[model samples]
Target chain A: GAGVSQSPSNKVTEKGKDVELRCDPISGHTALYWYRQSLGQGLEFLIYFQGNSAPDKSGLPSDRFSAERTGGSVSTLTIQRTQQEDSAVYLCASSRPGSNEKLFFGSGTQLSVL
Target chain B: SQQGEEDPQALSIQEGENATMNCSYKTSINNLQWYRQNSGRGLVHLILIRSNEREKHSGRLRVTLDTSKKSSSLLITASRAADTASYFCATDVRRDKIIFGKGTRLHILP
Candidate 1:
């Protein structure tokens, strides 16, 4: 793809249900990131992947949240037990190696846990 | 935790006036970049300043970085209605990942 692509654009789920958001990064980009933004709030770092390196999960809010990058092209973020507080817009971004400063972002998936 | 803190949570100014937002970070960084978000969607990268650079300009945007103070400022010249959006500053804290601030919401009064 010419730019980062995210799936579903919007997802509405009941509390305690699980949800999965997907992201397709720009081709050949070696770095991908996931961020969460609550209503009228700053973005919260969730996870990061650089090449084949072990993902940096220091930012994941809880064990319920997990992500995987398959074949270094697509990524998925799964929230095991959704809570109302989990409602937020999940963003995905990618950048070329050594160009982490310049990121290309996807439109994001707006998750609403009711 | 957020690596940067943007000043003035929100600002309202006339369309032709210039708007300036400041960001302060706590640790050494590889670089600092600014982005714009509209309607709470994805953000668009505006400019980036490496730790070694002090100032950079792009079109009507000017960015300044002060490593000693661990701060950066973004100035939008001749702001337009289209510039009414949220501005964020992101820092590469460890050269591995980027973290963004709470952002400054800019509203241009027509």
Candidate 2:
């Protein structure tokens, strides 16, 4: 892929509905990241996957939020029983190991929980 | 939670003027990067300054890093309306865990 790709660019789900957002990182990029951001606000780290290592989950806000990255290429962020607070843009970024925070970002998924 | 804190949460300037934003982090960093986001989505990498480097420049953008203070600043010279966007500063803690600040919302008035 030329750049990171995110699916269902915009989504509106009723409160309590479960929704899944997907991300396909650049080819051969071994690192993938998920972040949550309110409109015009800073990014909130959600989770990160680096190669085959156990993902760093310290940033998950609650039990309702979970994510998985399979095959080290595509990653999914799942929000269960979504609440209105879950409404925000979910961004995905990828970088190679030791890139020193040089991240390539996707456009993002705007998830609106009504 | 975000480790970096950007100052002047929002800034507005007329076109042709300059815009400066600062970011402060709490820990040792491998490097610091600045990114821009338009319409609140899609981040465009602007520049990165390694811990050992003090300053770097790219086009109209100038970045300065001070490891002693754990701070960095981005200066956009001769700003334009196209520069209107949210500017973010990010730092890497380890292999690939890059943490970001909320960002400074910059609006260039035409």
Candidate 3:
């Protein structure tokens, strides 16, 4: 893909349901990141992936949120027992190693928990 | 919080005027970056300034960093109506991850 791609641009789920959001980073990019943004709020870091390993998961809000990356390319963010507070736009970004921190972003998935 | 936070949650300006947005962070960083988002979509990288570099320029965008103060600013010269978007500041505090601020909404009126 020419740019970062994310699936299911919009999702509506009921409370207690589990949801999975997928991210396909730009080809050959070695770094991938997930962020969450609520209405009228700043982006909150959720996770970071370098290859298949996540060096930092400290940002994950709670046990209900988890993510994984495979093949150094696609990544998935899963939220368990979704709550209304979990509703937000999830953004994904990718960057090359030593690219001066330049990141390419995807359109993002708007998750709405009812 | 490694993510930088921008000031002035919103700003409205007339086209052709210069608009400036400021960001401040809490920790040391390797570099600071600016991004633009339109209508709550994906963000577009605008400019980046390394900790050592005081300033950088990209077309009409000028970014300045004050590492000693842990702050950075983005200046858009001669803003256009098309420039209306939300501006974000992110800090490259850790390797492979950048922390992003809430963002400043910019409205450039024609």
| Clash counts for the predictions, in order | 0, 1, 1
lDDT of 2 by residue, B1-110 (tens): 78899998999999999999999999898889999998988899999999999999999999999999999999999999999999999998765788999899999999
Ranking by DockQ: 1, 2, 3
Model 2: clashing residue pairs? A42-B102
Query: Chain B alone, TM-score of each model?
Result: 0.98, 0.98, 0.96
In terms of TM-score, the best-performing candidate is 1
| Selected candidate, larger DockQ, 2 vs 3 | 2
Using lDDT as the yardstick, the better of models 1 and 3 is 1
- Misplaced by over 4 Å in model 2 are none
**DockQ-based class of model 3:** medium
The whole-model C-alpha lDDT of candidate 2 against the native structure comes to 0.90
Candidate 3 is scored at a TM of: 0.97
Best by lDDT: 1
- Candidate 3 lDDT, tens digit per residue, B1-110? 43688987899999999999999998888888899999898999998888899989999999999988888889999999999999999987767768999899999987
